[model samples]
Target: MASVNEESVRKIIQYVGGKNNIKAGTHCVTRLRLVLDDESKVDKENLDKVDLVKGFFSANGQFQVVIGQGTVDKVYDVFIRLTGLGEATKQEVKDVAAEKGNWLQRGIKVLADIFIPILPAIVTAGLLMGINNILANPGIFFKNQSIVQVYPQWDGFANIIFVIANAAFTFLPVLIGWSAVRRFGGSPLLGIVLGLILVHPDLQNAYGLAQARSEGTVPVWNLFGLEVEKVGYQGQVLPVLFASYVLAKIDVFLRRHVPDNFQLLVVGPVALLVTGFLAFLFIGPVTMILANWITEGLVGLFDIAPIIGGAVYGFLYSILVITGMHHLFLAVDLQLIGSTNSTFLWPILALCNIAQGTAAFAIFFVARQAKMKGLALTSSISAWLGVTEPAIFGVNLRYRYPFFASIISAGIGGAFISVLGVKATSIGIGGLPGILSIIPQYWGAFAIGMAIVLVLPFLLTWVFSKFSKKKTEAELQ
Candidate 1:
């Protein structure tokens, strides 16, 4: 551990162009989000060579360094100290990175913590609903009334899993917020409380989103005739989070100051009410507006020239998914669900991602080295299921050819899907399975787009890899 601190941390910072080059940083379960001032200054090849840096991305003005979870905080700490960020101010105290607890081990731990625990919730709901669609409509799966009766076709036990799945994704902000608070030196439970308030069923029902839309502002309740308007907060990351962060700091400060005799009564209640109210009124709305603005901008782009824009979007989209920047697009799903009960982005994204995976799969089939082939196979399988970090970071980024092939293939697929004007009927899963999201209506067109994404890239990559291998053999001969 001491050796890792002295050696890896310094080398990583130097290779990434020193701490001065870093613009900002935020850690996720397996990576560090860095914004670099001059990306050109960093030696990507050298950085990749580092055992600690698993992968990285430099695009759209964001530079990300993938160091898994254990190293994230150490890297974050080194980053903050070097960058002089997260300082305690009069109104806000910056949260420092918590103690390191085995990065590689914790990186997997965090992934398991986020994914393994929640995957059954996602897969069960998705598969059941998808199967139900095939069965109830009669033809895809045996056309049996008993089957429909057992599963109930529409209102059966499947909904329980579906609820878990949809709820997990829909209110993912709370999960992230809870983790963020835990990372940021606050009570994870308190952050969950703040997140729940925003996403809670009671709060949602009391807020009366239907009335709010009709009246342009629904009254949450007439608090001293203040008329608190309910605003939607599902899947929102910033508002309640920011409010909680502020409250946590405030709570800490109050703990330091308020008289011991009356601290519990005055500070506790005031902190809760003040933070909760401010969260809904100020923090929630402001961040929601910002999130909305980002969504509107992206949606507007698609509406303008889906083909060209989608091509650009598809190319970057693959990179975004790999780097975790795709969360920005998830915000659009929230708005789409509210407006049309459908999200148009996922199908396009799914196809592009599948195309990249297909390319990786092709590479897996063709690569000469046993090591490369194994890496390609592992990553390709992961990509097939929609997790592209391994494919992109492990194989494509290192090999060079597959990487460019993926980008090109994604661009072609994106352009084709955009021109088709395909869209998803509802917010559902993504990756190959997400093709179902476009079912019953645009299935044919969606299939065409999906075919293009899945087939073209796979065939192209096979040809490219085969040609490269022949050239290499010829050179050796």
Candidate 2:
């Protein structure tokens, strides 16, 4: 990719139907945003295989090719030269794309806007937790032993890593509160304060409430003759999101109505006091009940019919990624991990990723085109490493059969793993190395699930490709 040159640019042009198919062209920080006259004319199989081309996806009406940040501009320069297409601004492309999404897609994009900013924190914590899981757990690293179990002296080191990673999960509500409120144009500092109150030390720890309740030690604040349980909202998602929405509205209304001279005095303190009081007295209790209902409903469904649950989720997860609805699940996954110490959904996500990657891998052996073969191989490897966009948009979805083969394979594997009760200790990388994040005892079950995904995608894709008349005719041509 570092050595990408004019030849690479020309190759990209060739893959996108020799530039004539392009209606408008532009570059973003990391993507080539092109509106194509006829989207199907672009050769997706070859596009991803183009030197330095990372991935491509058709969103709204734009066929966007992701070609890394530093490299994309260079590629776009050559693209402009070779195609003789008039340059379009990135915003022009966005406006065009923006005009095309449905209400659901637009809604999910808003969720994406809220979650994407916080991803680095969550992803880092998830990865660190995976490393710490290996170090702290028995039966993972050294044949039924942990680093602490053997060294004993290194216990603090492992515990320290856990402490670091667990901090993120423990205060997940705060992170969401800040991000969500900011997205809604509220004071982010106030969001942080509101979030802090949800996890205040005076309240009974949310996770420890059951034990505290059993011991009759749960704290309560008595107001007149009434009593309110002093319960904290640790890693709860819905409560924070709902409360943040209310906070944003309150801040906006106060700003509009309050007099400028007294606004500083009235707005900040009033907003803080009202939002905090309402969040604690009403919003907290209501949303916490609603959130628990949702959490328990999902848990009950999966527990009652894990195989059916897994199969349905696995089949749709990659599709969710395409629609960008998957961001919503990150919040849910964190909530589950916080409340239950594990999530059943993330393991299925890993399997779906593997299925997508392996499906693209099957294209390597089946295709005759050097470009398609190369792209398939690279994207597949990228998918195995946890980034599935390349394999999905670059190779599998382009080939149609490979994409279908993958999801079906994922469905099968998901059912198997779910039936076996495979679960993740924390959200982490979502492919082969994802095994490192699995609860150690479920490692064998996950492996068996992987075998199903690996073998099925390859076999199914190979068979399906045999019937691909278009690819076959293209190869013969």
Candidate 3:
């Protein structure tokens, strides 16, 4: 790694009440995530003036100083070396930081940590799925004929596209299991094997079982005369998560009890067999039912009254972001996609991203300070790209009006889209690019919702700022 000014970083320790106050510390791509003995001890004013400091915020019990891209790692190295604190991973720091947070906060942070790393694969597949939809769905290209229907030659091409796009969803358990188990401190490779067992080809497909079981025609294994259903998890989330957790715990427990000399031969196979049997026998069936209930409940909730549901979720989304609880919704979005083949909730989430982006964009035009303007512009662009924390915490929350304006605009926009019955094919990028994830037929509705969120937030925030110049100034100080 590169190095930064040692003195500048040392000054940070002084400003935050010396090295003793830091319980744990780590860095991500752009920020120093620190668990502190006392946040009040931080010299907020002087610390903000430190070299390479972009901004600072306390979230999920970590006093995070935004040190900007390509620079934070450098600063973090100096921080660890100067403070005599051993370097730690972001997860370790987060675990230490959990002491200061409630269970909800800690849980949200853990989920975010696990999912964020695996998002690239899901997002890429989603974007491709959208393209496949545009090509395969009728009415967009021809009045009554899809691209594949009219040009039969394109059938094989569309099939290949479908295969590629469907692979991620079909094997979602593998991704979730690997990531979740690793996060839970188990061997990741073992997680992959466990995932394979959950989705084994010998088992009846989970999606097929739902209909077959309803008709009492589902297959069973009859292992040891216990008569276990031979259903694969496929795209299921909760089951894989539970199974992975059990796997991790079992691995840790056995490692402590087993001899080190026989560890290599004993651990992997024993853990896999025990976990697989337990999962199919108890954990998988129970969690699968639970997962089904949650999926149906959320989908049914929206189906019963989509406009109200959309409006409620939209309005509260940014507030959840502020409280660090929004990460919990990611599982909901994923489960909906797995069960229903699409998610109505994500379209509204995309619009919410637009609202935050546009709200921050408004500040660029309204603010005078070059520093604030720069942050407003950059963070707004970031929000549009689906990372809204910067815009929310850096610009909108600071101005106050922008944050409130965004939720209101998002609520209205979400209601409109819900009325239009917009849905996403998969989890794609959020904000403007997120429109690509919408079902081809609902494109127009999503566009209109996008317009509503894009225009309203900026207009509302600007108007709010105009009426309260003194409040804005006082808050800025």
Candidate 4:
């Protein structure tokens, strides 16, 4: 492998149009996300000339630079140092807004990018809670009751761990906002601040948690005497994210217009503080309410007819996976909004994720190019652990038909799940292990979902791959 150095990354950045054109710099398991000012600004041929840069692509309005595995981080570091901003550094928040895909698809991809990394943490916490429930009930496991009784202190420690673990999900909006602002070239701290406001104690009680934690008092927000009702903003994104972008733009404008002498003291602090409050009091809550309504409307469709719901969701889910927006669903799960508490998404997502990985693995088996084979296999392994970016972007997406096959398999299986009325009582991360989140009664359905996800894609790849081979052979001939 070519050694990644400052000059290489700088050249990569310059080829992609330099610091001014960059909105944000982020990395997945195998690639770097660059929110560019203009897709045309990126010179793909020049970028590929660099030994370290594997490839560059533009889809869904985001320009992605594939660096492969550990290289992404190094490249991201160089990009950040050259620009003086990082994914978590919100101060330089740039507008990452892109006009691509439908609003729903875009929204899903945004959610997935922010949430995928934290998924294992979310699942582990949920599972620990579930297991704790089982252990707490002595009668269910009387055969092992003695072990539990002897470990009373262990229970308290376990509870503490669960609470802390769950906190990551509870406060996900802040995490996402931080990253989002950085991507947009704004202040990540602003995002974090906005996130805190959403999940603030006062707001948490506004919707319902107050009653859960206190007396029968649900905190209500009185907006100009129009008593708008809502709950805590834990794990929310729309409000804070929207606010961050708005604030970033406003901040940039102020810094440019105001005199340098008084800008810091007068313009900087005031702009951020005032805009942030306006966002928290009005923008955040209002937008969240709107998102809730949209989600409810969609869920209502599912209630009205499961088949349409299943097909639409499955189809969209597959699309979202490729663009990286699926994490938005988890915020609902964490906050007990939408179908989050119902475990409906995991089985479908799991199958799709697994299908893509399996297809990529097959490519490794048959690929003529030694380098392509290596990338395919490395990505395949990561996909098994629920980190599908490597597989999706590095392998499957490169060979378009594999991605199509995965999407088709996901839809078929997801449709079957919807027909069976198969739903989970709890949410877990998506992957093979995510199968554990299935309620015991739905074990058969889970198995079927897995079968379709795993088997269908392999079959599709088998059928389609012959053409890939023939094409290669014909070219060689």
What's each prediction's TM-score? 0.65, 0.85, 0.93, 0.65
Better of 2 and 4 by TM-score: 2
RMSD values for the candidates in order, in angstroms, are 8.9, 4.2, 2.4, 7.0
Candidate 1 per-residue lDDT over residues 1-477, each given as its tens digit: 432454676777788788787655666665666666677898876776577675676533346676655767676676666667563321121111111224543333333333333345434545555554554444344443434554665555545645654565566556655665555555667667766767766555322465656776554767786766565576554565477677677667776888999887876576667778887767876876775676677678888888887689777887665544565555455456444445667777777667767777877667665545655676676676777776776667655567778777778777877777777644446667776666444567777777777777778776666667765343212
Error of 2 at 168 (Å): 0.6
Q: CA lDDT of each candidate? A: 0.62, 0.83, 0.87, 0.65
* Model 4, backbone clash pairs (residues 3+ apart or across chains), number: 21
What tens-digit string does per-residue lDDT give for candidate 3 at 298-335? 77888889889899999999998888788888888888
- Runs in model 3 deviating more than 4 A are 1-11, 49-51, 77-84, 474-477
Candidate 3: worst-modelled 10 consecutive residues by lDDT: 468-477
The local lDDT score (0 to 100) that residue 446 gets in candidate 2 is 94
The residue-level lDDT of candidate 1 at 190 comes to 66
lDDT of 2 by residue, 324-392 (tens): 788778877877886788899999999999999999999888877666677688788878878887788
Ranking by lDDT: 3, 2, 4, 1
Scanning candidate 1 in windows of ten residues, the lowest lDDT window is 90-99
Cα lDDT of model 4 by residue, 168-203, tens digit: 556766676666665556666765665665677666
Which structure is stronger by TM-score: 1 or 2? Answer: 2
